[model samples]
Target: AQRHSGAAMAEQGRQRMADDRCNAGGTAEHARPGDPLRQHREEEVGRERGLHGALRLRRRVALLGHLGLQHVLRPPAAPLLGQGPAGARAEVPPHAGRAAGNYPMATMVYFQCVFAAITLILLAGSLLGRMNIRAWMIFVPLWLTFSYTIGAFSLWGGGFLFQWGVMDYSGGYVIHLSSGIAGFTAAYWVGPRSTKDRERFPPNNVLLMLAGAGILWMGWAGFNGGDPYAANLDSSIAVLNTNICAATSLLVWTSLDVIFFKKPSVIGAVQGMITGLVCITPGAGLVQGWAAIVMGILSGSIPWFTMMVVHKRSKLLQRVDDTLGVFHTHAVAGFLGGVTTGLFAEPTLCSMFVPVTNSRGAFYGGSGGMQLLKQVVGALFIVGWNVVVTSIICLV
Candidate 1:
């Protein structure tokens, strides 16, 4: 009877151990102290709280008094007739642009200025999240006046660079490269997003991102077509080529996502589209549609790879923390586009346009070495100037 009792106790002990093991293998696996799903839920809650805080902060900021007292309590203006330019003394006729006036022409010019301002605003991606909204409001006009104006004057305004034969057919150097450098510099000044914000929630408004993508697609009509300052065959070709390239890029990026993650994500498609747009900008009018197709493929693949691979391996990327990967998108993609332009420009196509050209870049026959060197020189100058000026502007 004693032996049987001892055996029974041992059996009970074994059964308890087996039961504990089974419990450990079941939901206990998910009950770890720091499961990723639990952490993700916590992150979502934190993000909601942060957004609520930011909204309240912005509301309070809006209530702060403006400089209305100075304007409202000031001395009255002198008579308009004696104050200044012809408008000060003369009443303009309402029907000024009836075939003998500056009304409609001036309106067109104003619209162009608006386009320029909007483009720079899009470049402000690097400043988001950490930038003081008030400071950005100030920085906008300042950057436009100081940086963008000079670039426009130099490249498109028939300034010294244009006369020196720097061909930016579109805006590889002016828009993408310049903005990339400036964005990086501005980020350095503004610092990074909150650590928790950075790691926890990348973009709270992915839907807004999709809307921005649609705007971007339509906006190329103005971005590239307007460069010709006319509606013409070349403009049509440019617009078509732009879309084709973007579509191809989007498809390629999506395919990449499927290969790796078993899903095709819209965000990846948008990234691919953006890269296609940036790459085609330099050669929009000059390259053939077929060439654009090839360029788009390369742009999508190379930048995607760079962002996923080189950035991961590089100390510089880690240090800069370029919030939206603007460096890879604009700077790297734009630079490559410029180089590709040197390789694919056809003299036949170049001659059809009014823009002066020595020869189609290297691949099209004449002075390949010279064309390659010119492209490099132009891209480097823009990059260097923007980096220096942006740093100074931020400091000031």
Candidate 2:
């Protein structure tokens, strides 16, 4: 009887694993119903990742409130809850409901939904205070359908870029670059905020903004770390690289502010932190700690120059009220990250993952040049697609 029961349990474990309902604690051997210790450990691992996601969601709330008080109060259902979630499924595995990687099918579905939600929220910041809520409500689904889905598929969902070996470790391109470009483009057609309002878009709540910024800084553990979809070495390195880049970027950005602006601005620090996070994301797990710091230094200074220097001179940028400077932070930082990944991605690290090819960074020379070219082409594809598609969506 005990033998039969053990066999049954093993069968159950195989079934669970086959469905991708994997636990963090162990493998098939730990699937016994009586293994409370392993089960507890599994729960702990899951709780950690879940909290990371929850923390991000909380931080996002703070950002929305800071970036757009009106949008914060408005409902997020603008995209039709049902519509977006369904599309997320398609983005992952169109042919099957099986688990895609280390996590469960349900978990994959959930995260995809969250990614979509966050992307929409990030894009909306550009149009805040100027566009009507009703128009936003209508715009969400249209943009998701026309702009986001295609981008997601082309990058993460095993489209040409994925096959061509463009590494995005996370959504530096698919989410940030695409949304930033789309947001800026849409903001163009939507028109700028009133001159008086544009001249002074004061924060509604500074304390909450700081609180949100702190949470956002912390939440990046999951933001970049969670891309590996595992609690292994890759995710650990990703978390480490993420923090290293962010801290370096923050300090650099703050120093630039002090040197040029005559004061260290809290907003400037937060912007720097975000750019660092975005900048390291594309190669978080694939690069060394030192590379992350190099990336951070560049991420901090480059975006600041563009937002502070270039924005003032660019007639097109000034004409379009990118209310939150999405172009500078997300689009520019994200594209920089992708290209940097091609320049820094380690071949040995890339060897661990079956999906990643062209792992050698340009810094290593040889085929690395090809990888960098691929990254540029991939980023350009996303930028072009968003600009064209977003304009069409906004026009309609």
By TM-score, who's the top model here? 2
Worst 10 residues of 2 by lDDT: 91-100
Q: Candidate 2: which pairs clash?
A: none
> RMSD for each model, in Å, please?
27.7, 19.9
Instruction: Give the whole-model CA lDDT for all candidates, comma-separated.
Output: 0.71, 0.83
Model 2 spans > 4 angstroms off: 1-102, 354-358
Candidate 1: stretches off by over 4 Å: 1-104, 352-354
Candidate 1 per-residue lDDT over residues 212-281, each given as its tens digit: 8999989876787656555544566678878887888888878888997899888888999988898888
| CA shift of 301, model 1, Å | 1.3
Tens-digit per-residue lDDT, 177-218, candidate 2: 988999999999999888899988787888898999999989
Q: Considering every candidate listed, which one attains the maximal lDDT?
A: 2
